[model samples]
Structures are given as C-alpha cells and as structure tokens.
Target: MKSIIKKIFLLLPLVLAWTACNDYPIDEDGLLITTRSECYVSSFELLGTDQRSVIVDVATVDTVAQEIHAEVNFGTDLHALWPQFTLVTDAKLEPKVTGFVDFSDLDNPRQWTVVSGNRKVRKTYTVYLTVQEP
Candidate 1:
C-alpha cells in the first residue's frame, strides 16, 4: 500500500508535465507561429484634420501593382492628414502607421511595406492621393 502511493506520486508529475507540453510553435516575439504568407493591402483611408475621412470615394487598391489611390474632397487639407491601412491576415506594416503623417507632396507618393506573418515575405506599396476638382 505504501509502495503504491509512492508510485502514484512519482507518476503524477510526469503526467502533468506531459500534459503541459504543447505542439504549437512560438516565434522570438512570443507570438504564435503561422504559415500564412499572403501579404497585401486590402483597403486604405485618409483622415482629415477633423479626424473624419477625407476620401471622396472608396480608395482604389491595386494588389498586382502594389499601389493605392485615393481622392479627397476639394479644399481638404492634405498636409497633416492621417493614413490608415487594412492588410491581409497575420500581416504587419512597416514605418508603423501611427499619428498624422504628411501627404502634402503629391508628386512624391508615400510608401509602406507589408510583412507576412511568417516574416518570409514583404511587399512595398505606393500611395497616391488627388484632390477632387471644385
């Protein structure tokens, strides 16, 4: 009876440890590993000074060309507008789209790079904006 209790105690920890083990992989950042590699910009939006969308129509996203085009209402201030992007699942953007960014220069379009979840693929996209004619 004593030996049986001793054997149970010895096997309890092994069973617990085995159950704790997981097959799921994790990256260096401690994020769950994924195999998805599809990376692209699905949508884009530009915000006005009042924090409202300045886009005149649905922004055009050219996945094949890796470019984005948006038209803003006439007289909309583009100097300090904010840009937002929607990307594929498990993908991330570089130059981290944060607070207001300057899109005042139309000739030199803004560029953003998207990285896949597996960190194996990258796509750089150019964004162009035009003001609607009054």
Candidate 2:
C-alpha cells in the first residue's frame, strides 16, 4: 500500500501539468473565451485642405522613435478635426475618435485609447504633433 501511495504522488505532478493549459481563457466576468485582438495602428493620415485631394500621412515629430507623430502647418486649428486611422488585429479605438478631436494645446500630448475587439483589454497611445512654421 505504501509503494502504491508513493507512485500516485510521483504521477500527481505530471497530471497537474497536463491540465494547466486550457483552450479557453479565464472567466472572471462570465465571458467565454475568445481571440483577443492585437493593438496596432496600421495607418495614420491627415485630411488635406482640398476635399478631393489625396490623404497625407502623419510623420514623426519627436527625436525619439515614437509610434504616433505628425507635423501640421502653423496656425492650424487642432480642434474640430479628426485623424483618419486604420487599425489591425480586429481592434477598436476608444472615445470613438471617429468624431471630432481637440488638440488645441500642442504642449500636451494627445492620448488615444485602443480597445481590443473582444473588449477585454485597453491600451493607450500618445500622439505628438509638431507645428511647422514658415
């Protein structure tokens, strides 16, 4: 009986390890397991003054390698305008940036929130826009 008990204990670790991995995610809020969307900004562009003109991509304004950056003409209105965004990995933007956005203060960085398609995770990104004055 003692030998049988020792063998059971030796096999217990292997059994636990096999059951550790699950095909589904943890259910904390009663939600089923689903594929989590990856956070990525595929395309970022600005609208031109001409309605029919081609869209211009926003470029980096900072010295460091930042994800989002843009350069705009001086005296441009930062408010009442929205940037066109193309996302990947089945992601969505928070605060519904599809509408107008306010960036009146260039000193402050703009915060954009990206939410997973499954609505399970949220991540924030900073956008820096530099004004190019002639």
Question: What does candidate 2's lDDT look like per residue over 30-74, in tens digits?
Answer: 444358766666667655434221223445432134257777766
**lDDT tens digits by residue: candidate 1, 52-102:** 999998999999999999999999877888898999998888878778988
Best by TM-score: 1
C-alpha lDDT score of every prediction, in listed order: 0.88, 0.62
* TM-score of candidate 1 relative to the true fold: 0.79
Model 2 residue-pair collision total: 0
Give the local distance difference test score of model 1. Answer: 0.88
Ten-residue region with minimum lDDT total, candidate 2? 48-57
Candidate of highest lDDT:
1
Tell me how far the alpha carbon of residue 126 in candidate 2 is from the true structure, in angstroms, after superposition.
0.9
